[model samples]
Target: MDTENCTNLYLQVCQTFLTCKYDDPTTFDDLYKLLPWLRQSLTCCVCANVIVDPMSSTQSHCQHFVCGKCKGGKMILRPQCSWCKDAEVFETNQHLVVLVMCFKKICQLIASSPIYEHILNYDQQRKKELAAMKSDSPAKSDTPSKRKRPQRKFARTYVTSSLLNIPVQQVLQDAMNLKDVDINTQPPTVECKT
Candidate 1:
């Protein structure tokens, strides 16, 4: 693969490895056994692409790096980021870019390893499962199950109580009196025994 493609693949594998790390700890542990420091670095949060040249609009709020293509596509729709939704006033993250560049060779080597292929297969299988679930759900809804709606033993009837019937005028009078009453003008009610 070309350098750019290799970088992209490395990023994809890294992302999948990290996702497996958090989401499926067992699988992550298995992968971790094969490659320990797989989840130690960052990748583009948007497209799972390698952030060779890291770009971020806001450092304080949205610190995640986005690749150029993803950022450009987002810019077309709106000037806000896909992950952070911050304005598209991005600055080049020189430090992160340099670090990623330095690690490119190592990433390329990892990309060629069997662990990377396993992660890639895992990602594809997960995607297939998701799609199957989505398709199956719509089919399930279309062919509704023959579930009988339960009949109520006693019909629900709402009854108003006449026990504590106060006139609306009395309620309004009380509310108006409350508005007129001032705590500052009221005298204290307590009587001293002495």
Candidate 2:
């Protein structure tokens, strides 16, 4: 990875890691609300789902993305642009690729770890509370001192030295040993057999 890009991605990873409240059930939604752009950026234009393999259309007018599954289905013929409906060629969108790579682990954990029913119940209760707050409040004609302000709530947090899967101490050790490493070389890959 380019050093500049790596630095930026590192910061994002740290932010997500720091924001997460492992013990809190609402951490997923909290992070979702915190990073509003994440959903739109990763969403597939065709299926309205998060793109696992993001491929963008070739047409200058049609830069919209279709996930691998959507494009793969049309691959038997020619892959079509979901938005423009044009018989278009597709290529990996590098920008989205980097974003996906950087955030994918944190996103997967948040989306899959939480129980769906708990999230639904929390949202429903939150809506009801907001509705009650709005309806019970006095008119604007009332003095500012007489009006009550809602208190801001923060998530319960814990102290830890781990960065996702890697320990912070290990990362520090690796950083110090980076001078001996080659940046241009690719890491070794393992082959899988069926």
Candidate 3:
């Protein structure tokens, strides 16, 4: 198979196998049977780890990389054009293209599922399409919209105890050693007049 088709095929197969999994490890070992080069080609594109799924008679190439569609990256198809984000053309001469296969059919399902038109470098077009999809009636939704939860909100911060209640400008000015005039006192200090 040509590189483009090979990659997309593997991805599609992976997507399919993964999505329809039952609570068993029936075909898990078959995931290791893909071509070695195909295995190395798509490992990094994914951002996180996921459980490897089993494939029946079909071959699976990648098993660990979490599906972008199901995870935080959103649903992007395998064999994404080097130049285009979701281009499905099957040209192999493109030097920038990377062929990949999926052990689970998640990628295939996502790729086939209807989605907003993908555009390259067209921020306005992409934004408009995204907005339209987001607002489209829930009745039109064939896929779920579960966004990954935001990371922990209580990480380390620079707002120290000394400046906890202090104004922002004062804190910034103090950091920069920028002096400010105090308006609360007369001169320095004054005894209360009886």
Off by over 4 Å in 3: 19-22, 35-37, 40-194
Comparison by TM-score, 2 against 3, better one: 2
- Over 50-102, each residue of candidate 3 has an lDDT whose tens digit, in order, gives 21111111123322232323232322324332332332221122211222212
Which prediction has more favorable lDDT, 1 or 2? 2
The model with the greatest lDDT is 2
Every model's TM-score:
0.34, 0.39, 0.20
- Candidate 2 lDDT at 141 equals 59
Candidate 2 residue 129 C-alpha distance from true site, Å: 4.4
For candidate 1, lDDT tens digit of each residue in 98-146?
A: 4455445444544555445555555566568867988887443566568
lDDT (Cα atoms) of all candidates against the true structure:
0.42, 0.46, 0.30
* Stretches of candidate 2 exceeding 4 Å from the true structure: 1-32, 72-83, 108-124, 127-194
lDDT of 2 by residue, 35-131 (tens): 3234433445555444555677766666566665686443211243344465346555555555555554444443454433454565577568878
RMSD to truth, every model: 28.8, 16.5, 27.6
Quick one: how many clashes does candidate 1 have?
0
Model 3 scores a C-alpha lDDT of 0.30
Alpha-carbon error at 164 in model 1, in Å? 60
| Model 2 poorest 10 in a row by lDDT | 154-163
* Candidate 1 residue pairs that clash: none
Q: What ordering of candidates by lDDT runs from best to worst? A: 2, 1, 3
